[model samples]
Target: MHINFPLILVIAVAVAGLLALLDLVWLAPRRRRVIAAYQAQVDTPDPQTLERLDKEPLLVEYGKSFFPVLAVVLILRSFLVEPFQIPSGSMKPTLEVGDFILVNKFAYGIRLPVVDTKVFDVGDPQRGDVMVFRYPNEPRINYIKRVIGLPGDHIRYADKQLYVNGEPVPRDLMRTEPDDEVPPGHPLQSLAKVDIYEEYLEDSAHLIRHKRLSQPARPQEWLVPEGHYFMIGDNRDNSNDSRYWQSDQMPRELWGMVPDNYIVGKAFAVWMHWPEPKLSNLPSFSSISLIH
Candidate 1:
């Protein structure tokens, strides 16, 4: 059977902590005084007493040292904020591979740790928010992507243009050239360079390299079912998202259409970029466009 690691951690920490707490709050004083008095009486610990005492300190030590740290992590990751690392180029230009990001735990709603059940009231995701969430297929694993469609939105992707509820979501040609260095692919050699002109997401428009050189016959139209969301990568043509996978093939373990529960939080800003020089040479954070 598959074991859930987070649940195991929580259970282990809880059990170890409760045992330790019992020892400290209820048993320590009494045991210590008894040991002292008995030692005075016998002047030496008997073999059985010595054997029992031998194991107590080790358990006490293990509980004392690790339980608090585990509990703190469980609380912080469960309630307030959690950090994650970007492992792929699925979000390339906006969030490069190796980028570390912070996800607001309470942004969508407060969820109990491990269980993912929402507890309190919270806000919903807007059009352009970059969000992190638990992959519906498996809550143990986390996935991050941009939120593109909401519930009941008749989302359509044809010839590279996004039509939401039949209204063409605006997009513009920013610059056209080989973005080969940008993503290591040759898609730019044939596609149009589209800049996201909306402000619902980032202030500076995110560049979506589209190779839409044709007429799309219902290229992809989806009536975003309830509770699930339509997700896409900043890299445009490169992401494996709602566009490619059919609903039945998508296990409920994956995010259902417009699932408010799958959402974890809205990403706010870039805290740090490494090799530091890349961001250092660029314009100030104020000048950076939060366009898409």
Candidate 2:
């Protein structure tokens, strides 16, 4: 089952805050008064009264210490920055499986947690920016991809080439051999051809992988809708992105553009890349580097 972590955090904060308030406003004062009255009646307090005076309530102690920390985490992650891991090769070369990346939450704007309603507008996503967003098909699941088409822009993918606004994007071939570093049993391992290229986007350039053995989806063009964006994975043939959406397999909600409110953040850096269990002995930092 999918656990809703944000909701859990919110609940934790509320419960902790309530326990702390109860102790501060009523329980602690009442206990102190009772202990003081018992002390006045005898030269030395009884074992029961002494125990009560010395022992701190577990709930109240924990609440008072943990609430502030949890509140700070919630605010920072929701507004400033958040971290994510790449689990697939959809953005290979630029991002790889096992890479832990930090996303700039305020780059696009600040949004309330859980509800994801954008409350501020710092900036809009630019072309070539790597982004994390709620999957259009499932709002609860997050996906990462590069922004290819902005609102009102036209995008076309054909013959393994990308076109934006009637201009063809440029690319330089980097390699043709299958990447030996690809994890064993990975889907890319069985592919006959793996081509890597440095594709130049409107503003920046990044590496992309192409699988020659896989059949290309028919060329398609899309006109991005207002307040929405078009995205595509860097691994062109292997990724199930905006290029191919079958009505039978996907809900109508994923027809084309991703709603603006669905954006999570802009992914900017790769902080770590631990070795996968399948290749534990291999160099863990083979793919460790800053993301473009």
Candidate 3:
């Protein structure tokens, strides 16, 4: 089952804050009054007795201790930056599996957590940006892909070439090399070799890869409606992205596009890579670099 982390965080912060507030408003005052009455009855106030009287209830104490930390985490994660791990090679050569990347949460806008209502407009996503967004078919799942088309743009992919607004996007072949990173028993491992290319999406230039002998996908075209975007993976033929989202099973209006509201953030940088969970293998920081 998918856990609603943001919702859980918000609830924890609220409960903790309430507990602290309860101690400040009701319990602490009552304790102070009792201590004062006892001190007035005795000739000398005992420090031990005063300390015991002033001690907070365990639940309240824990709540007060945790509130500030939880609040700060919520604010930072929801508005500033959030960390994510790449789970697949959909963005191969750009982002590898196990890469820990930081997403700029406020790059697109400031949206309230859980409910995801945008309260502030910072900016809209630009072409060529690597973005993370909730899957259109399943909002609970997050998927990352490159932004290919903005609202009202024409997008077409034919013969493995991408065309935006009737112009074919430029690409330069870099090299043909064996993919050593392919996991064991993967189908792509049988391909033997792949072609690497530097694709130019406006001013941003990024590397993309395609299996040398793999069959090309069926030609497709899309008109990006207002408030929606066209996204495609940097792995080209291997990615399950906006290109494949359109199907007879789905409604036409909801086909092959990422709605503005489903956007999470722009992936800015990769900080670490730990592909395997084995204790013998350690994570490496050598891949740390700003994402294109």
| Local error of candidate 3 at residue 151 (angstroms) | 0.5
Per residue, candidate 3 scores C-alpha lDDT tens digits across 214-261 of 788789899999999999999996888988854555465434889999
What is the C-alpha lDDT profile of model 1 across 176-244, one tens digit per residue? 544443454555554544333322232334555553433344577888877778887776766656666
User: For every model shown, what is its TM-score relative to the native structure?
Assistant: 0.72, 0.87, 0.94
- Selected candidate, larger TM-score, 1 vs 2: 2
lDDT of 2 by residue, 160-248 (tens): 88999989999999989776555788876866668999999967889898877766667889898899989888987767677776365
Model 3: ten consecutive residues of lowest lDDT = 246-255
Model 3: which residue pairs collide? Answer: none
**Residue ranges of candidate 2 with Cα displaced over 4 Å:** 43-51, 179-191, 246-254, 275-288
- Model 1 vs. true fold: TM: 0.72
Which ten residues in a row are the worst by lDDT in model 2? 246-255
Alpha-carbon error at 272 in model 1, in Å?
Answer: 4.7
